[model samples]
Target: MAQAMLLSLRRISRSFGGIQALDNVSLDIAKGDVIGLVGDNGAGKSTLIKVLAGAHDPTSGDVILEGRPQKLSPPAEAQRLGIETVYQDLSLIGTFTAAENFFLGREIAIGRGPALLRWIRRKSMGDTAMRGLEELNIDIPGIRSKPVDRMSGGQRQLVAIARGAFWGHKLLLLDEPTAALGVRESREVLDLIKRLGAQGLTIVMVTHNLDHLWQVCNRVVVMRRGRKAADLASSATNMEDVVAYITGAKEPMTPRPATTEAGA
Candidate 1:
């Protein structure tokens, strides 16, 4: 038998007064599947992700998680429901050490009452943070004590990912993870995303780079002008099709002039 769907956006809609950010958008995500959302600048890709990440509530419609209907009113609600999002900006405290950032806002308490304020459990937090990185197959040059400001862009991305994965989240939303990374760093980040998917976490990445989408996603959903244009299996379709969908060219032709950008 087939497995049950992990997340579903049922007729989801969001608007900004005169502008409809998303219009009756519906999507179903399965467990362990990597789906890429593609669109133009105003195509509502970010808005859709924000809704899924609990950054915005739908103007109308429901976001159902794990077969149960829910109203995701706040980002905290989604986080509590095992949904984690690592945005491009990735809100990390650069001044904090790796371990400090890892355990930020979630310090290990020593007791259940007022006596619990024993201070930050330094040793335990560092060890646990290191192990989490190891589990994600990340190699840290320094110990967890290294400040995030000292780490590379790729390392910072890894830290964001490690934070989400450590809690065994059910769904992870990635917004342009590889946008500014160099060749090797981009590859590393993509590999990590795949590893997370292999470990059974659903991933929904929003990117215009069809090459990255082709490399990391199993399915691709195209969004155009605040609406879904098409949803196709990556293997069954090529870059030409995606470009065609994005540009509204709908040209009856081959070799989309913008096809070469796929390997990046």
Candidate 2:
């Protein structure tokens, strides 16, 4: 049996005034697959990610989620549809505890009837947040009430990922997840990504590290000057070839023998 496509971009294009960030780029993302989106600076990688995350609406073309067209307008809408993103900033409030950060905008509320009658369920929120992190096999000592600012870089990244896992029922997009991390921290993040994939969560990670891609990604999509330069299976392509595509040293090609879960 063939693998099912979870998301599809058909002739997607986005422009910023006179600059075209993405141009007629078509791609398909399979269910339960970890995809690496790689490109040089200003290669439209971030733009494509924003388009998928509902942070940017394409100027032309369609975004098909599960075979149906969707006009994803706001980031909230994307989250509602089970698509979550963890950008480079992580977006966690430094002064906020892990639980607080986890339920930043979507806090648990109790009581009913009048708006004033209801209150934020603090205890329930902490319990649920801890439970969610544990479910993802993320081990963070004193995570429940600790301020994210006090945690190490790796711990913070884990918290961000834990938050995404708690809400991401379908897909998770990570942008430069390990960009600022040390060696050990980077390894931990990569391991967390692999664990998420093993649990059947589809993930799209944007990174410049080809080594990291080989660690977890099932397939890689290379972007060059606002186009889909290369779509190759991780097992079928090497770092040299990927770098070549990113630098425009070689022409784009769709390499074969992809993972069983990747139909592309």
lDDT of each: 0.81, 0.88
- lDDT for residue 239 in candidate 1, whole number 0-100: 93
Summarize candidate 1's per-residue lDDT along 1-264 as a digit string, tens digits: 165678878777899998999887777787888999998999999999999888998999887787789876598888878888888965679888877777776766565556445666788988998888898889977646678889899888888877877753788888898887888888999999889888888899998678989888998888888777777779999999888988887632232212212211
For candidate 2, lDDT tens digit of each residue in 7-90?
A: 888888999999999988887888998999999999999999999999999999898899899987699999999999998885
* TM-scores for candidates 1 onward, in order: 0.90, 0.93
The lDDT of model 1 is: 0.81
Residue 93, candidate 1: Cα error in Å is 0.6
Using alpha carbons, what is the TM-score of model 1?
A: 0.90
User: Where does candidate 2 have its weakest 10-residue lDDT segment?
Assistant: 255-264
Which residue runs of candidate 2 sit more than 4 Å off their true CA positions?
Answer: 112-117, 254-264
- Using TM-score as the measure, the top candidate is 2
Q: Which residue pairs collide, candidate 2?
A: none
